[model samples]
Target: MSLQIEMDDPARPDVLALLEEHLRNMHELSPPESVHALDVSRLKTPDITFWSVREGGLLLGCGALRQLSPEHGEIKSMRTPAALRRRGAGRAVLEHILVEAKRRAYTRLSLETGTPAAFDAARRLYESVGFRECGPFGDYRLDPYSVFMTLDLRPQTE
Candidate 1:
């Protein structure tokens, strides 16, 4: 796929639409309290880095990374529209986030996602990229509807 992944502003019309749909889907799959997806304003914060994946001007997916501290980060707002799933857009955006996190020298990356069946693909994608189940990492508390995962970004030394 000829995908273009770029760090972008969340205020773009197309990106805002995609983020809106993502929030709606999250709420539909989980209760309001369990839906932790950030809105546009939150994604625009200086501590967060947002990215968009596009192909030929079509927005395929979007995601963001929130800096927890100098050495840790959190993945947020990862979404690809239902019609655009399986097109590698989500993975592209995720890989881009991983690279950004590493580039910033973050030693750890964590995320909270829903436990619902609707989120199975997302969980699998994270796992495929070396994310493993872990305890809540930020302000998040333990919740039945939420699953937490983390990836150790430190380079392996032989």
Candidate 2:
């Protein structure tokens, strides 16, 4: 399927619905305090750039890059519809976020995801793109239910 990824307004009805579903899923999978999924209002901040993936005008998935600093960024709200999993839509959104991070000259990209068995696929997907486990960053604190991952975007100096 031809997937198109574009910057999107998080306030739109369809986008809001998808984000709500994502938040609901996170709450179901993780403890209340451990859930860190951002709501639509937070995603509208200037620091966050949100994008949605669509095929034939149907929303397939969405993801975002939040600027942490000049050299750092955080991946947030990456979600593919349950019915559309394993169809490359999530991967496409992720790849697009990584490219956007690089274009913004971020030296590192990090993300926080659940550590439960339900998150295995997500961990594998991030690993496939070189994301490795790391300690919490940004405003995050140590939480057993959360797994932090990071990818270095800087070029090798050698």
Q: Estimate the Cα RMSD of every predicted model relative to the unseen true structure.
A: 0.9, 0.9
List the candidate 1 regions with Cα displacement exceeding 4 Å. none
Model 1, CA-based lDDT: 0.93
The true-versus-predicted C-alpha distance at residue 79 of model 2, in Å, is 0.1
Query: How would you encode candidate 2's per-residue C-alpha lDDT over 31-87 as one tens digit per residue?
Result: 899999999999999999999999999999999999999999999999988877877
Cα miss at 153, model 2 (Å)?
Answer: 0.5
Which has the greatest lDDT?
Answer: 2
Residue range 14-120, candidate 1, lDDT tens digits:
99999999988888888898889999999999999899999998999999999999999999989887788899998988999999999999999999999989889
Cα lDDT, model 2, residue 29: 89
Which pairs clash in the backbone of model 2? none
